[model samples]
Target: MSLQTDDLLSVQDVHVGFGEFTALDGAHLHIARGGITGMVGPNGAGKSTLFNVLGGQQAHQGGRVLFDGQDITHWSVHRRAQAGLTRTFQISREMGALTVLENLLLAAPQQPGEKLWHALLNTAAARQHEAQAMAQAQALLERVGLWRLAHERADSLSGGQKKLLELCRALMLKPRLVLLDEPAAGVNPVLVSEIADFIRSLQAEGMSFAIVEHNMDMIAALCDPVYVLAQGKVLTQGSFAQVSAHAQVVEAYLGGVA
Candidate 1:
């Protein structure tokens, strides 16, 4: 694909390794602004490893990651998150002790209002900011259809609800690019549709996504340009139909299904 210079996320010649084991070998990918892209491959194809690198959990041995035209290759995970690049994990991280709303509120950016001095002397401003954060959190929860369970402890939510809650937390960051790692995993078929709808809704609102999923159906339904990785390198990337029909992609990643 001919990527535009306005792409929101770009990875060029990215190589990541864990000592002797190499995860990504000169991997290159990009996501356009407001686009939903899918990354698919078999287990051990380095999809999750790439996610860790991009999300700042893992370090890359070579190349760079550019976000919103800035080189953020060396930024820490929290710094990248603060800069509008957020990701959801394959395993959910809902705090059992915290309520759903509390989890969302924690995801909100901390400001000067959170300082002890500001809280004691600038009560009015702090209250105003807290109220705004609450309103934003509630709106995000409602958007993800979790408002009804806002008061419930996050641990009490079902698998699908927890997945939805994760999405809500990521949205609270008001991210420019979201890297979703199997958002539908552990979700029921019914709720999977809901998650898909929620992702579409977010895409419509000017957010971009690069999703890693094993479900071809979900990729087909949600992703535009799909990238197939094999042995830690991109095998092919195109529309669902185009990539699925590629002979090598089918043989290497799709198990002969084309």
Candidate 2:
């Protein structure tokens, strides 16, 4: 298939295996620029494995991955992230001991102070950069309604708050594509709505996303051109209404006719 310039991320015929087990089989999908794409499927459907492959956390045995028109199938996680792709996990991965503001600041790509020489010799530049990063972190915290908790230890935040922190940290990179693995899982209904709204607000500001979520309502409300995977392969791709009605999707999830 021809790669579109507007596709922020593309996966073409990717494959992965674990000894005798095949976790992914020729998974082909793409996240369009300025759009929220969702992935859903029954358990053991290779959703997480595919996510890992796309995020450069797993090595795929075959196929290619393209990001903003560059082949990144073999890129390192940090490399891919630097190239404008970042992701969050189903379980929050916040720094427990760090304050909320500190956690977000750490996700920013580069800091002059990060290099010993820069810290020692480039004091002026490092200070300026750190100041800018701190300002940006404060703005993001406020945007997500977490400004009041900026000084709170990350580990003290509730499950939903931790998820929000993870989301904000992913945004700290100003990523072009955010791969969210079940942003709503384990979150309260109110917080889930808040998370969904935050994503929509970001999408409006031109950030693209590829989310893997089981909340059908959330998917229906936020996604377009959803992809459904079954038994390690793509079963279908379309609007939620269309995929939910597909015979294969129904059978895969319910073991019966649609």
lDDT of each: 0.88, 0.90
| TM-score of candidate 2 to 2 decimals | 0.95
The Cα RMSD of model 1 versus the native structure comes to: 2.4
Best by lDDT: 2
Q: Write the per-residue lDDT of candidate 1 for residues 151-212, one digit (tens) a residue.
A: 99999999999988888888888898999999988888899998999899889888899999
What's each prediction's clash count? 0, 0
Model 1 shows how many backbone clashes?
Answer: 0
Instruction: Give lDDT for model 1.
Output: 0.88
**What clash pairs does model 2 have?**
none
Q: Candidate 2's residue-wise lDDT over 159-257, tens digit each?
A: 889989999898888898999999998889998999999999999888899999999989999999899998789999999999999987888988522
Query: Which pairs of residues collide in model 1?
Result: none
Per-candidate TM-score against the hidden true structure: 0.93, 0.95
The residue ranges of model 1 lying beyond 4 angstroms of the native Cα positions read 1-3, 112-114, 120-122, 254-258
Which ranges of candidate 2 are over 4 A from the true structure?
112-114, 256-258
Model 1 weakest lDDT span, ten residues long: 249-258
